[model samples]
Target: MPGNETTHPLLQRFHEGDPAALGELSDRFSPALMGFAGRLLHEPFLAGDIVQDVYIKLWQRKGEYDSIEGIRKFLFVATRNACINQNEKYRLRQGQPPSSEDADPDEAMRKLILSEYLGLIYQIVAAMPDKLQQVFYLSFEEGLSPEDIAQQLDIPRQTIKNRKVEVYKALREGLKHYKVAMPILLKMLFPH
Candidate 1:
């Protein structure tokens, strides 16, 4: 978990009580944390609140974590716990029996990993040029053929093919370290 210029390079500054570093951390992790909590609680509004609180807690415990890994772990765990607590309260308010089905630690962990990975992929895609982004969305997300995308965008079919290659290369470069999950992610992206 070495810090890169694009990712969590502010851990030391954060530990030293820098507000800008905390803001960067919030910007970096909030999306994945919100997605995890939203999936758990099925309420995006509550998820936002929970993620905000988790960041505040992180700021309070800044000295406790020496690395971004520690902060990442803390954010996920704290968000999950907060979501579970909120669910319990909702169940009680509704006069329903408490159920453990959604509280499975393994399932929650899987969702967290998936959300985080997807967030990274989205960040990579978002940084691409507008034309590349359009091609990527049409080809991968919409499962459009190169011919169809070229016709739709009024670009040459060969250009569509080339752009698709560029998108794949970008994704691979960004996600190269996650070797075990690469196949599954590629399968998802390249449905053809």
Candidate 2:
């Protein structure tokens, strides 16, 4: 980021399947993304997985990011979203999502537009059945192997695998709308 250090134009080439670009973007943003995820998850171990989830999403949808804001916002919003989504799902064992007043930001640069769409995704995830969503979030966002999640949760690993499959299917179906919306939203937002 310094004047002398060469920064790859990762935002440009990443969508084209450039691994080095992906690496560069990860390197550049990892600290901030990690911190954001950590804050949202309120757990260090889980936070690391959340950050990895961001990277995974980025890789899977590199072509989806219309701008740097798309990437940045997506990471932050998704982190918060995953946390809130899980919390809501858990609370529903009783009923209702937790009503935490999200602090207002003073600047747009402090947020990611990608997070907005991701938050929507999280809402969709939360609407899923409790056990299924829990398994999905644990494995998908936290990157726990099905076996590990099962060991930790005292559930069968096969159950975890089945839950993950269901979660992804639901997410793919729900977030399919973003494939069309992200670019259009980006064009409206940045006008570049």
lDDT, residue 12, candidate 2: 68
lDDT of model 1 at position 146? 88
Candidate 2 achieves a global lDDT of: 0.62
How well does each candidate superpose onto the true structure, as a TM-score?
0.57, 0.43
Number of backbone collisions per candidate:
0, 6
Alpha-carbon local distance difference test for all models:
0.77, 0.62
Candidate 1: pairs in clash:
none
lDDT of each residue in 1-192, candidate 1, tens digit only: 554623455877887799999998887677557656765684557988898899989989988886777787788778777887898888888899885656798876776676567556665776678788788778665789889999999989999989878888898998887754776877776675
The residue pairs in collision within model 2 are 73-112, 73-113, 73-115, 74-114, 74-115, 77-115
User: lDDT, candidate 1, residue 102?
Assistant: 64
TM value for model 2: 0.43
